[model samples]
Target: MKKIKLLKIFLPNSLEETYSKILNNPFKIGAPNGFEPIKISESYACAKFIEEVISKELIIDPFGNTEEVTSKRYIINEFTISRIRNDHILILENPSRSVRELIRKLSEILGTRFYASAIQIDIHALSEFLSNNRDSIHLKNTRALLSGVNLDKGSSATIEITSLKDAIHDARYHFKGKTFKIERARFTASSGTKKSTIEVRSTGLISVHGPDEKSLVELINMFIAEGLS
Candidate 1:
């Protein structure tokens, strides 16, 4: 499995303005080669959109009733973009092909003229695989589990980052050597100052485990400033 997320930075704008632009001048973004153009909007989760709008052939039964699409779609190289909240949320989930092209398209549509932030790249490694091939990836500075299935056990590293794009670039570079299938990767754009925003994004993954809120914020800052190197 593979995940791709992008965070587009911009000066503060009203939700109304953002919403109006999306509704009036809708834009199409890059997607997996055979997939449809990435749709940008202010409503609908990825799964719901697929079930209601995309072809039935493209939709598959989710692993759980919780709305998560099954992993089978990965083989076909599909992708989805979730609803965006202009203040600080732009999500691209399960981009199975042409990650670079997709990002470029998004950058063009979103307009880089607005100060954009680093692209955050997140990849989840199957715990079992990490256990079997510890030497493949360098997550040496292990910390306590922050999020994910086994909250008490899963661990990750605090790879510093100067920007999300560079960090993700470096992550992809390392991901090549590990050979472990990626479970998820996300790109986020935000003011990291917002607790609600961060919480919404950290719904999964054993994130940077810190001793306290201040420390956790520091870790996120480091991540956005430098790619996990």
Candidate 2:
């Protein structure tokens, strides 16, 4: 299934500030054919359009010779800013420098800060997803298993399990009403770092395990950065 992840753009102030800057001030940006302003409201501001840009691709001939070809491509994207409680969330496809650039322009115009970051999934959502798909995660669970499923404080420990799948014959426990945290994840060099088992449900619930902490943070960034694949 196609994964859908809404990237996070941190605004310097709350949603109310956005209203005074753009929504309240009311201004247009870019050419009429590019970055068109769609709508603004008391609740949210939405803008979306297709953008065409030049891109390059590699071609392999039957003789095993390789060549680079350049062409034009269109990018479809949407951006919405709204107040979810107290936080101002920038909903957009991430790692797209174009989008970030647009935000940068807006920042310069409004004198605010908008930062593109990789920390998308919050701790609670990840904790819930891991609770259910403990066996299906991408992290090195063998270490956690070998380290033992249960432990008390005040002791140094190191445990190892061959693999999460291999632990099918292992034990099960009832961990209801408990809180879990995701701190680290990694794949062995032998296994490589490519991960493909993540599923983003239709409801927009995404649960993706990672090869490492940095990889997980760059999940959405890599999605578009390597979109040619």
Candidate 3:
């Protein structure tokens, strides 16, 4: 009979329960280097059991935003099965900035109760594919498809004045350049200061940011309502 030394298994679910069950079996022994030596059948069983356990608990939301949740689940499973592999490494990839922060916070939260194995977050590697193809046609096409309507060439103008009174006046009805139907414009006072800013952008297409959120929102709404006029 050929001796199978190492077994690789991919489990979509919980690894903790699987590891515990494997450890309790009589035939397996914990090696000094951290891996547990087991018969091939037992190793296969552990992997299968992990998959079944995970399938039951995992759920996909309607929005299809489960990447973060799935990555963490895999990490947890790997940590629980650390002793099963001689050198266990859990490599997580392509997590968002917020997700990365959450993982660190979770590690700290679970620090005392259950020790997690060495976890490596490889963000750079995951994004490496995008880095190499920065100028690809596919990327350009994709961006164009998702971008809002082009409002750059439409009738628009910007005037900078020293006084807020002048700025608001110009934004309202002073300039008669193109008369592309004034959508909306807003003026906002600078916080903790005397200066202010104004912006007016067209509706469902472009947005102009000013000194405050209120100005931005109002301008956007106005652009939508008046742009059609």
lDDT of each: 0.34, 0.44, 0.28
lDDT of 3 by residue, 67-126 (tens): 433221221111112233423222221222222332333233234333323222121221
Listed in order, each prediction's TM-score against the native is 0.27, 0.39, 0.17
Report the lDDT tens digits of candidate 1 across residue range 170-216: 54465444323233333232223332112213322223222233433
RMSD in Å for all candidates: 16.5, 12.9, 23.9
Residue by residue across 1-229, what tens digits does model 2's lDDT show? 2223454456676554654455433333323224545777776677654455667889999999999999866555666665444444555533244554455555764565666544333323332344344344333233222222334454433333244541212212233332333232212211244553343322223334445434443443333223212
Q: Pick the candidate with the highest TM-score.
A: 2
Q: Name the candidate that leads on lDDT.
A: 2
Name the better of 2 and 3 by TM-score: 2
Q: Model 1 segments beyond 4 Å from truth?
A: 1-8, 26-87, 99-112, 119-229
Ranking of all candidate structures by their TM-score, best first? 2, 1, 3
Better of 1 and 3 by TM-score: 1
lDDT of 1 at 94: 47
Which 10-residue window in model 2 sums to the lowest lDDT?
182-191
Residue 157, model 3: lDDT of: 42
What lDDT is obtained when candidate 3 is compared to the true structure? 0.28
